[model samples]
Target: MKGYRISLIATAWLATIGVATAYEIDCPTRINIKSDHPELEATPEGWQVSINKNRSLLLTSLGVYSDEPVKLFELKPEIGIIDGKKHDLTWQINSAYDENGNYVKCSYNGEEVQLAKKIDPSMKSCWAIYANDENQHTTAKLICSTSKLQEVE
Candidate 1:
């Protein structure tokens, strides 16, 4: 009877863990940028920004390529996973033209990440970094094709 009780308890515990995990999706590995403004570069020295779905984080680094001083910003955008979660994100690193202004969109999310600066006149498309744990250093990439979000009205 004790063995049966132990087995039942183990089964219940396992079920509870499974259900909890099922509520959260794994972070993505890659994210693709799709935009009319196509002049963008992803380099170590270039600007990179990433958002973590799990940690609810947003990170940005500037002047990564040139001798110019680097700047970093970490903020938390209003993000939540009701159903589909966007672990990967496309970013607006540079702007080429002002026709559409600088904008970036991620998958499964309708909001766009607009640039705060007017550095580039033209729009550029680029991928942002993976929101890795500061200690663990893990990366999440986008699973499929790049997302095309509708412009906010």
Candidate 2:
């Protein structure tokens, strides 16, 4: 009876290892980031950039959040120079209806600050640090490539 039980446990362990390997895959090594024009809300979720007048590309982040954990989302916008062009992004989202059933939009009026220099074939990772802000808000969206996904030290 003891030998039979040990054999059963061994088979279960091997099956578990096989299933884990089957579901594992390597993420991308590099990603191209572009300005999500006409869309001001491009942070860690992904980026929407116009490649042409009628075409656009989208890149979104994937992960899970937990209680009071600190994380950094890195963003690398395409580098270039354009005269009289605006690079600022403004974020706005619709809020939950109030008791009177009125619709409203809350604005995240904070300015987007770049924490690292633009890399052209660049190797440096840009970081978007999220923590306690002046408004006592603890939530915000971030945009970054899969390669930039990492745990904060």
lDDT of 2 by residue, 1-153 (tens): 999999999999888662211111112222333444465565556645544443322212222221111223212233221122222221111112111121111112221211221121111112222334454544323222212222222
Error of 2 at 150 (Å): 21
What is candidate 1's TM-score against the reference? 0.18
What's the TM-score of each model vs. the native? 0.18, 0.17
Report clashes for each candidate as comma-separated counts.
Answer: 15, 4
| Stretches of candidate 1 exceeding 4 Å from the true structure | 1-100, 103-115, 136-153
- The per-residue C-alpha lDDT of model 1 at residue 92 equals 30
Off by over 4 Å in 2: 21-153
Worst 10 residues of 1 by lDDT: 61-70
